[model samples]
Target: MPNRYLGRRIGKYRVTRLLGTGACSWVYEAVDQDLEIPVALKILRPEFAGQEQAETRFRREAATAARLRHPNIVYVRDVGQVDGTAFVAMELHPLTLGRRLALVGSLPETECVRLGIGIAAALAVAHASRVIHRDIKPDNILLSQSGDAVVADFGLARALPSGSFPSDTNTVEGTPHYFSPEQARGRELDHRSDLYSLGATLYRAATGRLPFEGDDWYTIARAHVETPPSSPRAHAPALTPQFEALLLRLLAKDPADRVPSAVALVDALAALPSAPAHAATLPRLGSRTVEAFRPQVPGRFHRLLTAAVFGLVAVLAGWMAWGRTSSGSSAAPSPRPTSIDSTGNPTARGGAASGSGIPLASSGPPRDSTRDTTRHRPIPAPVRRVRLDLSAPDSAQLYVDNRLVAVGRWRGEVPFAPRLTVRAVVPDAPATCHTALHDTVLTRVTPGQRLVIDLPVRGCAVVRYRVEPRDARVSFLSLDGGNTLETRADSAVSFSLPTGRYLMRISAPRCITFSDTIVVRTSGNASPLPRKLFCS
Candidate 1:
């Protein structure tokens, strides 16, 4: 069905434009006529609306999300059913962090830290209320105009249950790349699972890359269960050792090894010196504090004078000098030391002297020697030629400073003779593209110098299959007796198998046994397989 954005108004909100669509719902930028505010309206997909169980789950999500009133959490304004369609009204943000990250390649260290802290703070609030945000990823984080971060998509979140799964059955309800080891193995999940997802999101934000990458969903999901993540510091060496340590702790296979709560993680982050806005422009350690300097009078005089006498004299002289300099040269340097002091502030004596001197006269008359040396001078031209080569495993859409320049396929070259920003994005995984401005004066791109860029696809194939009766469970058994694969109820039985053969089996109480020997080729479609049967 073509996406219909008609006169579907939920509660007092009037649907305007279609923002986006997900598997189960369609989101619209709508106006709340009663409240006279813009809100995001999420309506259940038409097919899912008829399912009572799905509707119940949707209602529960709204209730849980509505209870969370955090600065970093997207506010849910209203929830109701209109003309048999279930919809929710929520605070609307301009864009998602995922889109921004895609546009900029990767966020600066300071921005990543700030966003991470905000997300952690929001998660802490949810955890306090016994809610677990099972789906935590870059796409779920929204960015406000002021750069504040807010967590969205609480529809998949669930209240903490009292019991744990004993068998190979669990509801896998998160993006594969960000899923925790426990979540991948169909085991019990807690706040730690969310922490793992946060770490994955932070890893991408810091490095412009995902911790685990593969051609399909199973491969990436299995990496979460079996493979160790590449160090974030390896990709972005400028990241602090403390943050690297935090990433490792969050990615620990054992849930107990991770931070106990989101609040604790936030506290730990708050304790660390905030990541600098620009790596090249980091401030000195003591740059913000005022230094206490003792007056350096002739040694015996300094010791003999009382503290009150010295302080009073220094303050009076400082005020008189400050007034004199304030009206002096417009070109004179401000009354601040060029270098930081031991206490992180400028030395009082040095700072007081900067603006005290008379402005130096220009060295001789302003030179007009250009007229005398015109014959020897070289005229500079505006245009500069720069060779640009774009190469990737597959096709890429190339952009120069946000403007689409060309679309390249396979390993090829594009000679961009003009000095401009160059960015390449795979249409599917726009987030993985590399974006950089070419300044010929600062840097030169030579011919035969290939710029190799990797365009990350979703990196995993999500094969979703529903086992009938709700109670029936599925598992992938290796005919070679290697490892048993647990399956999630809401998700397909996934495994990171290469182009090879494997045996799968399904089991449940009083159900006919099911097993199959299937050859999974790399180039085949990603759709879920038809239900298979096994002899009891």
Candidate 2:
């Protein structure tokens, strides 16, 4: 059920409806009766009201945002409480950048630069306030109907000491893909950390893809700490060298190498070589603006395709070289950090085969040197493009070995790799409801070959229910009298089905058979079927 106070007044504002909810707080669209203005009222969740840490973090967001009032920053308007439930009211924004991206596959270059400048301007003010937005992903940025973007959500921001800034590396607090290498290692962080995340956001805006792809958090986090991403041109060809250079520098594995500060980044972006009022003419991929964000789960071995990968990351390392710039200085390639290189580490031997389940480095440990020394190691093979035609519903995204390659019915070239794994997801479906509806393939693509695959979508509904006895035998059947699927009923069950009426019957030890009929609806709007039907 939605939280109470949706229509009730809290302090001077009347909560109209929920804007969004997170693990810590709930944001509501409200009207400030005293001021006669629409405001975003962010309230600490009632469930977490008594927790000291949650309360501190909630209040800390207000304390931090209140001090950084700039045009591009979503500043707090009021801080008050009602009946021991504290809330902060700020300027209302209709949508978030992450949501906006989902609606449009990627932003035009001009719009991307404009948003970048706005976010950098906001960060400059926050940096001046001695605060660093540790979490600076698309989800935290809000956009207005006027095409203006504002940086919001300071819940992960931390206050810095005067003249010195360092962060504890033990607890990695930010999103894995956008997190800096230092942040991934739980090391000290300065303002540059936010810039690195900005580059990630820009990369997505320019390319409609994430800089890194992984099945789980640890794999992505490890890549942030170790692997270096390819240039922006590798994803979006129309982006200028100057623009790509700045983004690469911002994403430099070393914080010292990133754009010095938000102010510097704004200046650099302003002077971009292709600083036209619009983007260049080029073919863009994808069907809609979207973020391929896979929520971070605790780093555990994913059982989904355990038989899939062994020599996972042997990319044909052909990095796009940065040529001479307007300033006549060519961009230099950033050397891979020695600290992250596991080639010489004692633990590098067959660490991936140990069943740790964590994603191993793309390049596994080197083969035996003595045996290779006897014969010349043949030149490394070039990445061969294999043409593939894939079909799916609109707004569906396809990934090859975690790298987003296509959307919808796409015919494109894919880098040749053995044991290639393709996974497709429909953005509109809820995670639980569409779990079985995903399309996945495990095979090898022959170079210079063309292939087609009709991505099968498992159209189903998830009905969650519980039984009186944990060990009750349950049988699931389709109303069309299709074959039944039987299993023991545990705490709760969630199943997807085709559009139809379905029946579930549970038979306990000595009790009579209990049953319920559920109606499966459309694909989108996958609200979980609340398990309220208790069978006794």
Best by lDDT: 2
Candidate 2, 477: how far from true, in Å?
36
TM-score of each: 0.53, 0.52
Residue 374 lDDT (model 1): 22
Q: Estimate, for each residue in 265-344, the C-alpha lDDT of model 2 and write its tens digit.
A: 66566556544333111111010100111123313353232223212311222221222243334434323322213332
Positional deviation of residue 430's Cα in model 1 after best superposition, in angstroms: 35
Instruction: Residues 373-421, candidate 1: write the lDDT tens digits.
Output: 2233433434433444544324445444333445553344444433344
Model 2 spans > 4 angstroms off: 274-536
Q: How far off is residue 439 in model 2, in Å?
A: 32
Superposed by TM-score, candidate 2 places the C-alpha of residue 28 at a distance from the truth, in angstroms, of: 1.2
Error of 1 at 299 (Å): 48
What does each candidate score in C-alpha RMSD? 20.2, 22.6
Positional deviation of 531 in candidate 1, in angstroms? 53
lDDT of 1 at 327: 77
